[model samples]
Target chain A: MTIAAMQGIVKRYGNELALDYVDLSIHEGEIIGLLGPNGAGKTTLIHTLLGMIPFDKGSIQLFGRTEKVFSHENKQKMGLVTQELTVFEDLTAKENLEFFAGVYGLKGEERKKRVEEALAFVGLSSNAGKTPAKFSGGMKRRLNIACALTHHPKFLIMDEPTVGIDPQSRNHILETVEKLREQGTTILYTTHYMEEVQTIASRVVIVDQGQIITEGTVNELIANIQHEEKINIDVSTPGDVPVERLKGLEGVKNVHVDGSTVQIISTVGSGNLDRVLSLVKETSGVVGIQAEKPDLEDVFLTLTGKQLRDGEEE
Target chain B: MTIFTFALKRIFKDKTNLIFLTLFPVAAIFLPEPEYWPLLPYGYHYFGVLILFVGIRLTGLLVEDRQKGVVKRLAAAPVTHFQYLFQNLLAFSVIVIAQCIFMIAGGVIYDHELHEPLLLLILFIVFSFTAIALSLAWNSLYRNKETSFLVFMCVIIIMALLGGIMMPIEMLPDVLEQLAVIFPTYWLAEGMEWVVMGEDTADFLLINGVLLLYTLLFLIIGSIRRMG
Candidate 1:
């Protein structure tokens, strides 16, 4: 079942178009990655879906019904884990989840069981009674997600959930989301990290300027790109046949020389290493070689002509 | 259990509120015991306004929620707007009552004053609810705290003058008194005065009922505007 849908949604803020006629939908079991640059209306779209903001045009539906703009029943069926630490900093993790559970009208044994389940799912059980101030950023975010899920909403909206955390916490959060998806929850996930979408999102939607440019599976996204092979080689002999002969190799696209490194792009995943290696051996140079498959980041860069991280693309 | 208890526990965590709750009302009692107290006319109304100020400080709790980004999260959560507003009202009313009790107790202990506890309780509940509703109203309209505080002070001053807090309705010109009839503060102060000076339970009841009605009105309006 399609859990949520947005059609021709338009949002404006004082002459600025926050979201312009954007169309997207998520299924009951698929985790859709809403990828975008900053100022790209990802948060705005999430806010609109949550009925926290007004849109100038279009329609949104949740669970086959027209959206009620934050109605009781609708809110009860949805969960939000925002980027910022929305959990009460003063309240312990358990207290925060308990408070949210109470707000959802959960009571007595039911609320306690849910809180325990959520805390355990988020791997925050040990930190249950600890205040957010004493917890790390990653732990707090996990608690935030746990609090949001205290009522067990079927649809989840996570906006940049892993903005800045240590590697270990990011890995933990990603793993937890995978577990949630395996349980049949639909997720509208947004992030600047390309690798995150690779592991969890079944498909990726690239949003920019209040609209979706294109969306597809990772393999489909990178399918049409010319250079599938990137070869980074460190050479010793140095200047012989140097750069020109390397670019001339069969299936080799381009070669650039910098200091002690020669970078080569191979057309397709043609195992361009062998031919390049032969040429290098004849030229009395290349020593080290490493080839890697193009991950989603390369695909994203190839499709958008923009880098994932804020401004390092150029 | 109840969200109210959770809110009470949350409010108590601040600790500063507990200190202020006691100090505010006691200080109000001590400020004017005799000649020095009489130096300012209608001192009771000033204390009432001070009580409202205490209420406004409690409203700053919303500021903390905003600062922490909890408001947005709550807005997105499964809880309805009614639940959120009620939670705030529950918390706000608890703190206000805490302060009001200290003031009333100081009246009994130091001033040797005694009136109807039921009347006073009704009046205090109304006052606290109104104060919180007004604060939420200001917060919804103006995101800035200073602006809301300014508007609060202006309203409280206007209320102090028109409602007979500083000057009784009988002393005011007929036209101004008629104008005072429209302000919530007038009702708030009138109810409080009835609780203090009048022994007739009906007068106290009448005044307290009006304030309670105002409290409900503001609470509904503010909650609707904010949550809706």
Candidate 2:
């Protein structure tokens, strides 16, 4: 079942187009990673879906209701974990959860029970009384997630939930997200981290220049790219390398050189590895060579022609 | 109920705010003054100043919330914009009323006789609403907390100084006295004077009516600017 759908979302800031006729759909119990570089319309799309900002033209349907103005009931069914920590610094972890849960219309013993459960879920029960002012970066991030989950929203939207936390907390949050998926929650996770999406997202949507350039499962996206193998060669005599000679090799799709190292992208089922290795050895004194399958990072680089962390053209 | 609870909790979380809210009004009651006043008791006039103090503190709380992104969090919640404003205003009104009660009790303990205690109570309640509206209106005009606080404090101090809360407006030059009439503080204090003097019903009605008009105007402007 389709849990949420955004069709032809068009948004502009003055004369600049922030989102240009973007479309996205999420299925039940699936973690859809909304991947993009900075200013790639990822945050704009999330804000539009949450009705935090109005779009110039579009329609959003959550739970089968297609209304431009989301009713309070619709908002109650969705949870958000923004990239920035939104928890109150003056309020304790428990108070923060209680306040947000109250905003969601939870009350009495039920509200208390849910707040407790959320704290436990985020592994902050021991420090429930501590204010976010004293928490480490990772604990604050966890509390932010717990505040959103206190209401038990079926559709969770996390925008870079693990942006600047410790490795343990990042892993814990990823595991928690997986557990939420197991419990049948539909999540739309946005991040510029390809590895994060590779680990958790069932489907990946790559957005660039205010539109989705490509989207599919990790393997599907990788398979869609023409490059099947990526070969890296390091040479001892860097100045003696011939760049054009490797590009002329059979089945070599593309070649990039950086100082002493040479990267060759090649097509599948082509006996080009030995030829490329021999050519590199003859041209430049080879120190080490590696050939590996193409992954999502390569797919992103191929489609967008830049690293995920690199800024795109405005 | 949830929003009210949340607002109240937020207001009380800062112990310093509670301390100031309690101590400042009590201190205002003890300022040296003449034994015999012309229009109303010094206590009643000082009570008006207490209401403005509460207004400043409440507005400060709101400014802090906006600076901290709590307003943005609430905006994304299930609550509507109107509901958020209403709940916050309601919570502030409760605090203002409590302060008013403390002022009235202090007056009684000081053996200050009020000619129309019931009418004075009504005037304070109406004036409290006006203060809330004014604070909201002032908050909507500035985005930065420091600027908002500075502007609001300036307005409050200037209004209180010129509108006879700190000193009788009659003592000011004719031009300054005329300017005082343009402020809500002047009209609210004037209403209290009428109540204490056992003035004609028309005089009382006109003063309170102007207070309500100011409340309506401020509320309209605040809501329009905030929603925009």
Query: Each candidate's DockQ score against the native complex?
Result: 0.61, 0.63
Counted clashes in each candidate structure? 1, 0
lDDT of 1 by residue, B45-73 (tens): 46667767766667766665666677778
C-alpha positional error of residue B190 in candidate 1 after TM-score superposition, expressed in Å: 4.7
Off by over 4 Å in 1: A66-71, A227-230, A238-265, A269-272, A282-285, A292-305, A311-314, B26-47, B94-111, B115-121, B141-221, B224-228
lDDT of each: 0.75, 0.83
Please give the C-alpha DockQ score of model 1: 0.61
In model 1, residue pairs whose N, Cα or C atoms come closer than 3 Å (at least 3 residues apart or on different chains), thus clashing, are: B32-B37
Residue A145 accuracy (lDDT) in model 2: 92
Q: After superposition, how far is residue B17 of candidate 2 from its true place, in Å?
A: 1.8
